[model samples]
Target: MTEIDVATKAPESNATEQPAEPIESSPAAGPAVGEHCVTDRPTPAGQVSTGEIIKINDVEVYVSKPADYPHAPARFLLLLTGGTGLKSINNQLQADNFASEGFLVAMPDLFNGDPAPNTTTFASQEESQSLIDAFKLRIVETAKSFQIDMWLARQTEEKVLPILHKVIDGCRDEFADAIKHGDGIYAVGYCIGGRYVLLLGSDAQPTTPGPERPADEEAGETKTGPLIKVGAVAHAASVTPKDFASLRVPVSLACVENDALFPDDVRVAGEDVMSQANLEHEVRVYPGVPHGFAVVGVYEDATIRGAQATAYEQMLSWINEH
Candidate 1:
């Protein structure tokens, strides 16, 4: 399992005083706990095989490969993580499912070997402060290792993007021979990972520009990589309006009607932002479901599982279309 050092932001006093609501109940009945059901079979393209971990910058990423060996070059599906890390049980299962569909899935560990606390269970404010400060210091040091300008951006992006670029580059280099045979590359993300997918689509640094732009001009758009065909899946998490305005790829936001973190109004606000941005996007809410409903085992409710299956089907359809 992949472990991530979770940074606990200080809880606001007002937030602490408020009580969290109960979990929402869903209408659709779903599979029971420990039930392993294969709703869809792999489309005749190939079988799925696990790939070895490869390092991109300081981060270690696990990959899944196609079994039948594509006659053409292989495309990739980059899996992003949420607040928690990629080793979550649900994430592993989702990765396995995608791999079975013949897409090379890359799961990067963003918080390994760091001083950040694994959980935010600190009892005292002082203790939490000390831990957070220490974690920030570690982040600064890590940024220095990559020669990145930490002052300019958040630690997560500063730490993550370089490694992501490296992985994309490595994929191209390692599979250059196969790529020459004509397979395409694509990306997908979930939660924070979903956000990264948007970043990679609109802001990835270009290592190589296809025929349209000169190599020198490409650097001017350092954050914009060659338009690699991409699709993104943003679950319960919401994107800021300004950021939504900049989205340049096909994306989908799946929301649960009763999500505690993002209720219907919040989700609608996010959807509105996307609409204003004029980006190709869609927002669908499953009635009576809660946040993390798509994740199997965590909720352990039949209704949640049913909603999850429906969401999975939606994602699969989007992926196939793109």
Candidate 2:
């Protein structure tokens, strides 16, 4: 059975040893995990065949290629991690599943190897709970909703879009021959990552030329362009209808029925936008599945597992058909 690839810190060696060779900064050099080099060791059995960190554009991406790599220049799937970034165990499993199935998976560390901003605060449980209570009461007293839109807007523009460009740029620059040559690139996003996926398809064209730009651009002229051909968003949050209307390619949405962030009405609004635009799409509500279902691996509920499996299959099918 396939197992999660957990990153373990090597124990400190007390004895002095010969000086290690100066590392070169090249794809052949492989990525570094602190002082030790990832290329020094082989990917363990049962884990994805090839797992290493590589610089895409300039940002680091944890790439996992299948054992049967170079079989046919497999389709490339650029997966966007949720707010938890690449450390999310469930997100890692999702990427592994795709790589195991012959899709080259590249996941960028959206947080640049740092914890998400809102993940921690106050430095103490008591202080955190007090703030939470005050925040909750403020929300209850005032009808003002959370500023998810503003947060998403800033993140997408400042961090997400640039990283995405770099990842695609890296794919074309470094892995052209290793990956399938065509525009078979796809994207899958969870939570805030899902919102980024929607923004990638959103109507506002990136000021910079990207893979998602019009087909009229000279082919092969721009290697760093947006190349995502299709996409899927799972239990996405903070995305609006205008976002759906801006999509250039077909997309599928695996919405959780119990998603408070992306509730039934929000899902319906997105569907309505897609339909009005006459875009080819699929939007389904997975009953009983809650938000973050795709990114929290420790939750072992049977229903959540089944829902995740179904959603994964649906994304694969959509990518296959489109």
Candidate 3:
């Protein structure tokens, strides 16, 4: 069998307001109300005054919080991690933005050491050109190879969830008093990280999503699974409609309109799957942006920044609602 492709790839007001009008949750639908470059509110204030890297059970997570809120009560525990490759400057920035919104943000370096982001440059723009086609084929195969390795080794069971367990423990210790009152833990991921958090929604065992238990889980399990109150992802790669089959919590997916790696079909499939499962979810495609716009392009383009802001608000709104 061919390996599946693994593509190389914020919060609002405190006052409660009327519920947002639901966006279309199906792939075949057209754009929704807030899916465009529309910014009706002021830029959210960045309350995060401190940004530092902290160790959580030996795993390094970039931690950010309000200087005054160091011990302030948390509203939720946020596990924010970025895309397909290594962490980037922008990833930290994205995390900081969420932290500013008053969550106890924990963005972990799941891959251990920093690795370079995947790079691709095409020789031609023509759709029928052999060079372009070959390049596209290579991307698919490469992404597939990467996803296979991830599924075999770095998935939630083997790596991320374990890290999250430790990180949550560390947060409880670090914010001993404040974290005690948080409503719940929420996650926001980009690209590959997005895929991981989505996988958390599944009841199936990680690494191997099946009924057969791994040797470690053969005996009745003692620890609880990663309990995410809600999840939101943007331009996620390597996830499919089937992945959402058992997701019990609400999710908000922010898709890029022109993303080559995760295009309309992928977004539509996710919508279809979630709808079929009768899951509470929303799908919004930001118009005219490519993949990775939420983080990388937020600083480079005003239009992208606008889209990012909208996605950020919508994510927070969804989390707040649930």
RMSD of each: 14.8, 17.8, 10.9
- lDDT score of residue 208 within candidate 3: 31
Poorly placed runs, candidate 1 (over 4 Å):
1-51, 70-73, 112-155, 176-184, 203-228, 236-238, 258-266, 296-299
Of candidates 3 and 2, the better by TM-score: 2
Model 3 TM-score is: 0.65
Error of 1 at 5 (Å): 35
Candidate closer to the true structure by lDDT (higher is better), 1 or 2: 2
Better of 1 and 2 by TM-score: 2
**Model 3 deviation from native, Cα RMSD in Å:** 10.9
The candidate scoring highest on TM-score is: 2
Pairs with steric clashes in candidate 3: 4-144, 5-143, 5-144, 6-143, 6-144
> What TM-score does candidate 1 reach?
0.60
Tell me the whole-model lDDT of each prediction, alpha carbons only: 0.51, 0.59, 0.58
What is the per-residue lDDT of model 3 for residues 50-102, given as tens digits with 9 covering 90 to 100?
46787878888777675457566665546555433224555666666777777
TM-score of each: 0.60, 0.66, 0.65
Local distance difference test, candidate 1: 0.51
